[model samples]
Target: MSKTVVAVFSSRGRAEQAVSSLREAGFNKEISIAAKGEDHKGGRGNTDYFGATMAADAGDGLSDGVAAGGLLGGLAGLAVGAGALVVPGIGPLIAAGPIAGMLSGAATGGIAGGLVDWGIPEAEGRQYEEDVKQGRILVSVQASDNKADEAASILKSQGADRVKTH
Candidate 1:
């Protein structure tokens, strides 16, 4: 069986560090990240995290495509499908990996709804959503039962808050 481990970070740097650590730990896939877009400041801008224009439709939102070469810091050059999504009530957000697609399709339901689909309890999902709205970053890793604890540990060692595996 496989399990999903999720955590929230108070800073983008910490989230990126967790991601890097996960990658170093042999987790090259099934990693997801979501953060309040750099342009999410009072919903006042058109640019995304990498300065890509936000699209009206979810299908086109990922127009930026592969983000391995665009992101900076610890997340730089990490091969993953990424883009900007305009979420209802949450404004614009920069999302990458599997959760990015979920957030795109979620629309009115937002992040919490997507997390529920990932097996996260509704109330916990809502709390995570609230944390993101408060400007934290969310990171999740889907791993086999044998590796679930390791994934969670990597995230926790990187300073992840509320690290939970479900």
Candidate 2:
């Protein structure tokens, strides 16, 4: 697996820029973006999220043809496969790309849960979720350890907050 780098931004615009910069910097791996449930332009009740009801499951692989919500509509250009979703800890959220695709199989938890699965601390994952709840946009990418440092630097220069690596 590749080293992972996460960058949080106060706005979707900045997050998008970071994605672009990371892409430009040759960190062309899977990039995932997530935003608050309220930041999107539509309702959570809509049939746009990847819907799979589960009483409990750690995480499953994604199945295709799931409903992607309005939260992902605007992020389509930036995040590879943007979609709106609801995980356990995180209420309603917008997500994009392979990370979200992997989450397409998740049922028991939210973004925080996914972060935990990826080795991020539980407390830090929760904090990341809270940041999203506050209208921050999150961008995550997997690269070589050295490249992750470069990605973090790129995000910092682009005004990314909460730059983290794992």
Instruction: Report the lDDT tens digits of candidate 1 across residue range 11-54.
Output: 76788778888888898768988777655232223445545444
Which numbered prediction scores highest in lDDT against the true structure? 1
- Evaluated against the true structure, the overall lDDT of model 1 is 0.74
Candidate 1 clash pair list:
none
Best candidate according to TM-score: 1
Candidate 1 residues lying further than 4 Å off, grouped into runs, are: 40-45, 49-60, 64-79
lDDT for 23 (candidate 1) = 87
Tell me how many residue pairs clash in candidate 1: 0
Per-residue alpha-carbon lDDT of candidate 2 for residues 97-120, written as tens digits (9 for 90 to 100): 766765666646666777877778
- Separately for all candidates shown, the number of backbone clashes (residues 3 or more apart, or on different chains) is 0, 5
TM-score of 2: 0.74
RMSD each, Å: 4.0, 5.7
